[model samples]
Target: MTSGRDRLIEAATRLLTESPDREPSNRELCDAAGVAAPSLYHHFGTKEGLLDAVVDRAFGAYLKRKRGMLRTGDLVADFAAGWDLHIEFGVQNPVLYALMYGTRATSSAARTADDRLRKALHGLRDAGLLRIDVDTAAAMTTAMAVGCVTQLNRERRRADDPFATAMRSTLLETVTGLPASPSEPEFAARALVAHLEATSEGFTAPERALFQQWLRTIADTTRTVQDGQHQ
Candidate 1:
């Protein structure tokens, strides 16, 4: 058996999700939930209270999935997926996504999502994929994602739209300074790591691992410095 509160939430969810145009009036909500007007007041105190609950229930899953993303070590691929999910969720739940991020005051859930982005950017830095510090990368990534989603939500981008991919690719290229194709230096270094393993390189597995690590540091730094001088 559910209480009046749950019933009201369920009804509101069904109605609002069906259409985020506007909130149902108290009478409509009460009628849909089979409860009295005062029951809503008794349970939620005010219409805002009920709306807050509705927002929480709607966005909870989005937050969870955002926090859990990109477990694979492929930072580039992971961030691309993250961008897709952000745009998709926003496009699907415009009213709620806007309400959550539309405000100057971010909710706790939003902050948590922001933290996850920073952590992922840091992972990119660890992989020698970042051109800037972790903080700058995270800020740039967050800003770009929010801007993309907000604009796409306004434009009502479809699943097949190329705008999301275009914007994501552009932002990543600008921030990371990576070519559209794989970096030649990084490619050569990765091939060397594989060759070392394939030929046994007169070393054990652990020794090969350490050698590859140092090689990556040198190759990444060399690229970074060269890219800087050309700017």
Candidate 2:
């Protein structure tokens, strides 16, 4: 049997899907759920809280699917799939996507999604396949993905729209330096940092920390030189 809380969520989800451009009224939600106003407050505290729960439930299911397929050994491919999945989810659930990520404050589900991306980027860094550090790469990739979703929502485009495809390729190439090998010293330095992070048998904690900083300097210096060359 569907509990009153579940009914409210289901009604809100339906209403959001039905009118992606509008928010459902609390009275409308209560009417659809066949529950009183007090029922909603009792279950979710407020309308915004109910919306958050709806977004959480929907996005949690989406993340479950993404997590299942994001670790097939090839981290770059995994990242690409994850990107596609994000855009696809946005296309399918524009209102939910907006609720999940369009706010000034980050949602818990959004943070979890970013953590997954960072974990994959860490793997790529360990394999010497990333030109930038993990955090920078994650930020760039996420910014691109979110911008793409926002654009698609504005334009009412499909997930496989050419614009999305081009953005994905461009973002990946810039962040990961794909097709062009990570042959630079920066890539080597990043790989070494990853290695040092894993093995700590010989050095004390402070020593390991200092050595990692040195490796990061090497990586950052190479990146600076490359940037200067580009300009």
Q: What's model 1's TM-score?
A: 0.62
Which portions of model 1 miss their true places by more than 4 Å? 17-21, 25-28, 37-45, 67-70, 133-136, 180-231
Query: On residues 153-201, what C-alpha lDDT tens digit does candidate 1 reach at each position?
Result: 7777763267766777786787677754334455345435544544565
Give lDDT tens digits, candidate 2, residues 99-199: 78765126676777777778888888899888988888887887888789989989989887979878878877887788532224654455456546645
Q: What local distance difference test score does each model get?
A: 0.69, 0.77
Question: Which candidate has the top score in TM-score?
Answer: 2
Clash pairs detected, candidate 1: none
Shift in Å, residue 67, candidate 1: 5.8
lDDT of 2 at 97: 80
